[model samples]
Target chain A: MFGLIGNIKAVPGQRDALLAILLENAGRMPGCLAYVVAEDTADAEGIWITEVWDSAASHKASLSIAAVRDAIDRAKPIIAGFGQFIETRPRGGHGLAAIAPA
Target chain B: MFGLIGNIKAVPGQRDALLAILLENAGRMPGCLAYVVAEDTADAEGIWITEVWDSAASHKASLSIAAVRDAIDRAKPIIAGFGQFIETRPRGGHGLAAIAPA
Candidate 1:
């Protein structure tokens, strides 16, 4: 499975707003095995998004969905930048549907 | 729920060795909701471990389990260092059992 782990840095004091947008759009995409958004404990302006998808294509394709596009547009301003972006090959674990290792 | 995202840096050319130890211990803890290990695309020596648990205490308690402790011992030598460790509070998302927002 395809996986991504990254930190989204919100504009100072805009973390919650960015988080709201993220949570609102969570789990609505096709081929998404998991899409978890969490509040970063140390960095007040940072949020972590951990995702597992069936394939990289599915993840890329979700970008064209209208609601996802809208969320991105809405979040553009408050998004200061992104950091620690890493692409991964998920080999599955508990709470996830069984995924054959790639 | 408790969440953690971090990168484990393995000694040169030992990523797969470290990864083997991690994968061997995956998902056996009682309160662990998810524990996905992945190969970092950008860093040849890096592995990302994304974890979610029922609570922080459960995560801490896991360290005491014989199997977990043994895995840690086996992994210690090949582990060069750690990076980007972040604690998080997970609200909920796809593939996770429903978690009440904390």
Candidate 2:
């Protein structure tokens, strides 16, 4: 499993628009097992995303998709700073035992 | 479960030290099911964290501990913006089926 983690900033009032973009490309993205977008309760302008993909390659490939590209382009103008993507693997938790190997 | 997500910035020269503080309280933090601190591959100074807890109350209580307090206090100077915390529950992927009912 792979992860695509990002720290996003929504424009002064473009929060809804940004969320829509994320929703748009989700599910359709190959290797996407889970996609989560979260808003910081204390700071509405800040947002966090956690995605699980089949591989790092699939995640990179998602960037080239038309819909994904468009959404990212639109978001760029409103964003202040884009952090580098961090990749992660699930470490612990029996709650995720379903993910155990056969 | 609950979540404690944050966007943390380590001082220009204090990344390793900040991580040490987190490591110190990690195992001891009550109700802390998982605590993750990830750095952005593209931005050396940017970081993302995702924490899962037993409950919101337990997460709050963890903050009152001496170790947690020291870590937070040490890291605060390096952090830029402390967003309000947003809690989340795991949603999908059979991988997490282990967390389901007995």
Scored by DockQ, the top model is: 1
For model 2, residues A1-102, the per-residue Cα lDDT tens digits are: 565666677778876677666667656777665565655555666666776655678778889989989888888887866544556643222222222221
Clashing pairs in 1: none
lDDT of candidate 1 over B1-102, digit per residue (tens): 899888899999999888888987676787888788888888889888888889999899889989989999999999999987789987666666443223
User: Mind giving the per-residue lDDT tens digits that candidate 2 earns over B28-93?
Assistant: 565665555555455555565666565678778887988778778877886665533455542222
Question: Candidate 2 regions off by >4 Å?
Answer: A91-102, B6-102
- In model 1, the Cα lDDT at residue A47 comes to 89
lDDT of 1 by residue, A1-102 (tens): 899987899999999898889987676788888888888888899889999899999899889999999999999999999987789987656566443222
Cα DockQ of the candidate 1 complex: 0.68
